[model samples]
Target: MLAYILRRCFYAIFVLYGVATIVFFISRLTGDPVSIMLPPEATVEQVEQLRRALGLDKPLIEQYGIFLANLAQLNLGDSLRYGEPALRLIGERLPATMQLAGTALVLSLLISVPAGIISALKRGTLSESGITVFVLIGQSIPVFWLGIVLIMLFAVHWTIFPTGGIGTWQHLVLPAVALAFNMIALVTRLLRSSLIEQMGSDYVRTARAKGLLPRSVVGKHAVRNSLLPVITVVGLEIGSLLGGSVVTETVFAWPGVGQLLIQAINYRDFPLVQAIIILLAGVFVIVNLIVDVLYAVLDPRIQYK
Candidate 1:
């Protein structure tokens, strides 16, 4: 297990480095940072000075070396537009994003796991059929549209919750629901299938023959065995929810990394943009690492390999 973990850690490091290298070069290759950062009427000497100051005058390799060195020290450089430290800006906005994503993940799990189990248990019933339709609709709907519809109903018409902002619990409802909807559908489907398979297994029948109650047979035995797939889906979805908040945050004006990324892009703020991408990638890597560790706890027989 330890060897497997070490191998995965090594793989994660390489993946991060690869992602960083891609992000670094792609940002540079796509456009002229100096042109975007400078004024239209700038003199030749002024442009040259700016290039030297930002190290654009150096060879690509040297600039990358500087970036890697600074990154090792956690110095993500300054925001092109804000003139602030990239890490500081990310730190300021990270908590709100974490709060939003965390709440949405909890809501998704609470809603999905039970719905899945009940639907599986009642597989052919009218209620179960209805739930299937619900899941289909949830999966089909786009999150941005959902956010808009939610705002129209709850915020504009009902005026119960604020349409946008990060002020209070009321402000969190629409965005969280929007973010959680797709995850809920996906998790429900995954869990439902897993539960059905577990129920049909020979061990489940054996447990029942031993005179265990149906609930205990399903809950204690079937559910745990069924959880491995659900765990994988949930972990991936949670990471995506945290990092893919760009559109939802934009629509709702939520103060998260996604929104920050948008602002950085519009201004061609390369440092901030690069930092945001790296930070998000790091978050994703960390979440998956934790999920990998969880597999050991979920099933002892499952080795890391």
Candidate 2:
């Protein structure tokens, strides 16, 4: 297990490097930040000074080398727009994003698991059909549109929650629900299918034949085996929620990393953008690693090399 973890760590490092490289080169294609930061009345020498100050005067390769060196030292550099440390700015915003993502994850699981289990048990019933339709609609609707509709219904029309912003629990509701909509649909459908398949397996049949209670057979014998895939999907979704919060955050005006990322992009803040991308990429990598480790715990048969 230690060796397996070490291997995954090495792979994660490689993936982060690749992501940083791609984002670094692509950000330059948007043109110079100096041009965007400066006014039309600014002279050529001012632009040159700004460029030198930001180290844009250096060769691209050399700049990348410096970036790597700083990254190795856990220094993400200063935000060109805010003039604060990029990583510190990210850190400031990280909790809100995490709160949003974590709330959404919990909401998705709470709705999906029971719905999936019941739908699987009910198969051809009207309740199952209704659940299927609900999942379809949830999956089909765009998150941004859903967020707007939720804001209109709950925040505007009913005034049950705040329209946007982050301060209290009520402020979190609409955004979390909007962000979780698709994930709930996905998990419900996947878990339903997995449970249905597991229910028909020989082991499930054997457990049933042993005169075990139906609930015990389903919950213990069947559910455990069916969880591996669901866990994988859930873990990946949680990671995606961090980055995918962009649209939902924008629609709801939530103060989170996604919102910060949009502002950074608009200002052509290369360091900030790079930091956000790398931070999110690291999150995704770490989540998947956790999921992989969880496989062994969930199923004893899963052995790490």
Candidate 3:
């Protein structure tokens, strides 16, 4: 297990480096930050001075080398727009993004797990059909549209929650629900199918033949075995939610990393953009590694070299 963990950690370094390289090069292609940062009436000499200050006057290869050196020293450099350290800016927004994503994940699991188990156990019944239809609709709707409709209904019409921004728990409700709706559908459908398959397995039949209660057979035996795939999906979705919250955060004006990322992109803030991308990519890699380790924990039969 230790060896396997070490291997995964080593691979994660390569993945993060690749992500950083791609983001860095692509951001440069979006056009010079000097053009975006400077006023239209600024003099050519002013532009030259700003360019020199930003290191854009240097060759692309040299800039990339400097970027690598800074990364090696755990420095993300100063934001071109904010004139603050990029990592510091990201750190300020990280907690809000984490809170939003964590809330959404918990809400999704709470809604999906029991619903999926019930739907699977009661297959071909009215409840199962209803849940299937709900899942289909939930998955089909786009998150941005869902967020808008939610705002209209709950925030504008009902006035039950704030329209946007982060403050009280009420402010979190709409954004969390909007972020979680699709994840809930995905987890529910996957869990339901997996549990249904597990219900027919030899182990399930053996447990039943041993005179175990139906609930015990389904809950203890089948559910545990079905959880491996569900856990994988959940872990991956959690990572996705962190980065994918861009649209939801924008719609709701939530003060989170996703919102900050949009601002950075709009201003062509290369340092900030690169820092956000690298951080999110690292988060995704770490989450997947945790999921891999959890496989052994969830299923004792799964052995790691």
Candidate 4:
């Protein structure tokens, strides 16, 4: 397992490098920061001087080499807009984004797990049909639209929660629900299908023939086996939660990394944007690695090679 993990980490380095390289070129294409930073009335020499100072004057290859060398030292550089270290800016906002994403993930699991199980167990019942309709609507609605509707209904009409910003628990509700909505639908559908498939397996018949109770057979054996796919979804969705938080945070005016990301893009802050995207890509890689290792934990037959 240790060897397998090390191998995955080795591969992850290449993945992050590729992400960094792609972001570097793409960010440059938005036009030079020198043009935006210096005033229009500034002389040509001032423009060249500022460009040289920022190292934007260097050739693309040289700049890339410098970037890679700086990245090796864990230096993400300072943001052009905020003049703060890119990583530091992200760090300050990291907790808020994580809080929002984590809450959404928990809410989805809390709701979806039970809903999926019941839908599978009840099969063609009204309960199953109702849940099916809920899932359909959950998946259909846009997160931003849901967030706006939530704000209008709960915050505007009922005055139940604040429209946006972080201060108390009330601030979290609207954004969290919006972020969790699609995930709840996705996980519910996946788990329901998996559970249904597990119930029809040979082992399930054996458990029934051995005189196990229906509840025990379904809850203990079938549910446990069905969890592998659910685990995969849950793991992958962490990154999705962060990405979706972009929309949710915007609509709700949440002070999270997603909001900061939008601001950075508007200003064409290359270093900050690159840092956020590459770090997010790294997160996805790490979560996927964890999921692969968890497969062995969930099912002993899944040995790491």
Candidate 5:
């Protein structure tokens, strides 16, 4: 298991490298940052001099080499627009993203677990039908749209919460719900299906035939086996959310990594953009590695070679 984990950590490095490479090139292709930086009436000389100062005058290959070399030393360079270390900016914004993502994850799990189990237990009944409809609607709603609607209802008309920005729990309510909407539906449906399938499995039948309590059989045996897929979704969702839910963050004006990324892209801040993407890719790789480790714990049948 340790060897497997070490191998995955090794692969994670390549994943981060690929992400950094792609983002570095793609950011440049969007447009030259110097163009936006200078005034319209600026002379060619001013643009060229500014480019040289920013090292944009260097060949693309040389820039890439510099980027990789900096990356080796864990240096993400400075944000072009912010005039601060890119890594430092990311660190400042990370806690906000973490707060939002954590709230969303908790909301998703709180709503999904019981809903999924009950929906499975009461299959072919009204409760199941209601849960199905709810999941369908939740999945169908676009996150950005949901965020706007929630603001209108909860913040504008009702005045129950602040419309945007972050501070208290009131400010968090709308955006978190909007971000969690699809995840809740996705987890609930996945868990429901998995539990239903597990209920029909041979082991489930054996547990029943042995006169075990129905609740125990369902909870201990079926739910445990059904959880692997749920865990995978949860792991991925947390990573994605932590990376930043761009739409939800934008809608709520939440000062998070997602909002920062949008600004960075708009300004073509290459160092900041690259830093954010690489960090997001690293989060995904680490979360997936954790999920793989959990598989062995959840089901000992899964053994690392």
Candidate 6:
């Protein structure tokens, strides 16, 4: 297990490096930051000074080396827009994003698990058909659109919740529901399929023949075995939710990393953009590694070299 974990960690390093390479080049391709930072009528010397200040006059390889060195030392550079450490600016925004994503994940699981079980158990019945329809509609809708509709309905028309901001619990309702809708639909559909397949397996029949209760046969024998795929999907989805909330966060004005990311992009703030990308890539790599470790924990048959 230790060896396997070490291998995974090594792979994660390669993945993060790939991300850094892509982000570094893509950020540079967005045109010169000095041009965007300076006024339209700025002189040549002014642009040269700005380039020197930002180290843009240096060779790309040299700049990349410096960036990597700083990253190794846990220094994410200073934001051009905010004049603060990129890491600190992102840190201030992370809690709101985390709160939003965490709540959405929990809500999705709470909704999907039971619905999936019931739909699978009643495979050919109206319950199953109804669940399929719900899944389709839920997955088809866009999160940003859903968030807007929710805000209009619950906050504008009914006044049940706040329309925006991140100060209190009331602000979380629309965004959380919007984020969870697709996730719940996807998870429930995957779980339903897995459970249905497991229910018909030979071991499930053996359990029933051995006088196991229906609940035990389904929950212990079938559900446990079928959860491996569901776990993988849910883990990836949660990680995605954490890093990909830019749209939802923007729509809701949630004051999270997503909003900050937009600001960085609009202003051509290379330091902030690079830091955000690195942070997102790191988060995704860590989540996937944790999921890999969980596979051995969930099923001892999954052994590591």
- Give the per-residue lDDT of model 6 (tens digit) for 1-305: 88887888899888887887788878888888777788999999999988898888999899999988987787889998788999899999999999999999999999999999999999789999999999999989988889899999999999999998888889998899999999999999999999999998999999999999999998887888778888899889977787558988998899999889999998888889999988888888787878888888888989877
RMSD of each: 1.6, 0.9, 0.8, 1.0, 0.9, 1.3
The residue-by-residue lDDT of candidate 1 on 149-207, one tens digit each, is 99999999999899899998998988999999999999998899999999999999999
Sorted on TM-score, best first, the list reads: 3, 5, 2, 4, 6, 1
Instruction: Give lDDT for model 3.
Output: 0.93
Point out the worst 10-residue segment of candidate 6 by lDDT: 238-247
Instruction: Kindly report the root-mean-square deviation of model 6 from the true structure over all alpha carbons.
Output: 1.3
Candidate 5 segments exceeding 4 Å error: none
lDDT of 6: 0.89
The runs of at least 3 residues in candidate 2 whose Cα sits more than 4 Å from the true structure, single-residue gaps closed, are none
Residues 16-51 of candidate 5 have per-residue lDDT tens digits of 898999999998999999988889999999999999
Candidate 4, which segments miss by more than 4 Å at Cα? none
What is the model-wide C-alpha lDDT for candidate 4? 0.93
Give me candidate 1's TM-score against the actual structure: 0.95
**Model 3 C-alpha lDDT per residue in residues 1-305, reported as the tens digit of each score:** 99999999999889988998999899998898898888899999999999999999999999999999999898989999999999999889999999999999999999999999999999889999999999999899998999999999999999999999999999999999999999999999999999999999999999999999999998899999899999999988988899769899999999899999999999999999999999999888888989999999989889988
TM-score of 4: 0.98
Q: What is residue 89's positional error in candidate 6, in angstroms?
A: 0.8
Cα TM-score per model: 0.95, 0.98, 0.99, 0.98, 0.98, 0.96
Positional deviation of 9 in candidate 4, in angstroms?
A: 0.5
lDDT of 5 at 115: 96
Residue 294 in candidate 3, Cα distance off native in Å: 0.8
